[model samples]
Target: MRLVQVAQHADDLERAAAFYSALLGSEPTAVFDPPGLLFFDLGGVRLLLDRNAPTAVHYLYVDDLAAAIERIGDRAEVIGPPHRIFTHEDSTLGPAGHDEWQAFVRDSEGNTVGLVSFRAVA
Candidate 1:
């Protein structure tokens, strides 16, 4: 299936927009100011931030790890340092692989946003 966009709920639109702007390195492609939904382009994928609702455990993989972190450094609450997650056995469709650098963040509401970088497959 083709994945177009994933919504990450937020409590504050301006706050969330500011955070995402930093993380994405640009303003949202579109923003519904009333509903507080901001849209961002992530490589080929799209990300939608919902200001009224909060989502949890949302995983986002990006090509530029450091740049992503720097963008959201001051806006979102980052958990810890970046580390690789290897041997993800939950999915059998693939073999052993490195999870690459992973970090956590809590938005205005309480949704846990997971940013990750996948190691190149061997």
Candidate 2:
């Protein structure tokens, strides 16, 4: 079966929306304010931000880890600087011959978010 949705807690929907929009490079797909719910399309997967949901640590794939971090700028706090995490020798979890890089940041509502990317080894 394929994954559908992932929910994360947000104390302030508007602030969360702004931070995510910038990081995702797109506006939210849908937002319901009365019950406090927000959605973003992650290539068909729903990323739900709710007022009452428990906080979750989610990782997002980026084309360029450094570029993504730069785009985030002061919008979020960079808790972990970008660094290489692994070098794939075979196509098991990631592309073979590429290096996996990751970094961490705190979102607007205080959720830890991980940013990941893969780059070919030089």
Each candidate structure's count of clashing pairs: 3, 0
Predicted candidate 1 versus true structure: per-residue lDDT over 5-26, tens digit per residue = 7877877777777877776667
User: Residue-wise lDDT of candidate 2 within 1-122, one digit each (tens)?
Assistant: 99999999999999999999999999999999989999999999999999999999999999998889888789899999999999999999999999999999999999999999999999
Worst 10 residues of 2 by lDDT: 65-74
lDDT (C-alpha, whole model) for all candidates: 0.71, 0.96
Over 4 Å off, model 1: 52-54, 64-67, 87-99, 119-122
User: TM-scores of the models, in the given order?
Assistant: 0.71, 0.98
Task: Name the regions of candidate 2 deviating beyond 4 angstroms.
Answer: none
**Model 1 C-alpha lDDT versus the unseen true structure:** 0.71
Looking at model 2, the pairs that clash are: none
